[model samples]
Target: MKLLLDENLSHRLVGLLAAEFPDSAHPRQLGLRGASDQTIWDYAREHGFAIVSKDNDFRQRVFVEGPPPKVIWLSIGNAGTSAIAALLRSHAPEIRAFARSAQEGLLVIEKAPL
Candidate 1:
């Protein structure tokens, strides 16, 4: 499944994770920088992207509105973009499974405690 990196996430992640998540997009690249969450959510639903975000807003929305556009909530606080990329890569299988699941709307990913 493709990912649409949220504003809170570094846009560079799209390129960094491209090998695994092809065609992923970033709000800046889409001219959606500073756009509202509703607008971003609508875009993802129309284009079939799982929203990847460090913020909790999208996670909250997914629970209340369920699928079409799923959410991959990154719970890694104040992390660098590389760390975020590594976390996602390590969880690629689970992320794909979550995207394919018909009933689940949210996937909360956090750094494995050191």
Candidate 2:
């Protein structure tokens, strides 16, 4: 699934996770740095991207609005980029399944196994 990495994530993650998340991109790469959450939400909806973020704002938005574009909420706080990448890689299958599902709106990835 294509992911629009929120500004809170390192832009380098785009490259780091590219093999698995082909065509994934960050806001800064799309001239969307500093854009409001709603703006990013709209862009992801428009572009068929699953929004990957550490921000709770997006999670709350999904809870309220439901999904046109799904959300993968990274709950791993204060982790390094490599740790983030590894977490994502470890959960890749689940994330892809979540993306494909019509019923589920949010997938939260925590620091420890859940």
Candidate 3:
């Protein structure tokens, strides 16, 4: 699934994760630098993107709103961009599986298995 990186993430991550998650984009690159959560949600739903973030807001939305635009919430705290990218790349297969899964809307990834 294509990823819509939240503004909370570094815009540099777009290029960093491109090898595994091609076509992934960041809100900053899409003229959505300061867009509201609702607008980002609407955009991801309209297009085909799974929102990846460290924020709890989107994850909470999934419990109430379900998927069309899936969510990959990075539970790792205060990590750098490369480390975050590595975490995502290491779980590429699982992420792809999550993309195809019918019932799951949220995929939380932390440094330690949780």
TM-score of each: 0.97, 0.96, 0.96
Q: Which stretches of candidate 3 lie over 4 Å from their true place?
A: none
Question: Local distance difference test, per candidate?
Answer: 0.93, 0.93, 0.93
Q: What TM-score does model 2 achieve against the real structure?
A: 0.96
lDDT, candidate 1, 1-114, per-residue tens: 999999988999999999999999998999999999999999999999999998889999988898879999998998999999999999999999998899899999988998
Candidate 2: C-alpha RMSD to true structure equals 1.4
Clashes of each: 0, 0, 0
Best-fitting candidate, scored by TM-score: 1
- Those runs of model 1 whose alpha carbons end farther than 4 Å from true positions after fitting are none
What is candidate 1's local distance difference test score?
0.93
Name the TM-score of candidate 1: 0.97
Task: Please write out the lDDT profile of model 2 over residues 1-114, one tens digit for every residue.
Answer: 999998999999999999999999999999999999999999999999999999899999999999977899998879999999999999999988998899998999998854
Per TM-score, what order, best first? 1, 3, 2
lDDT-superior candidate, 1 or 2: 1
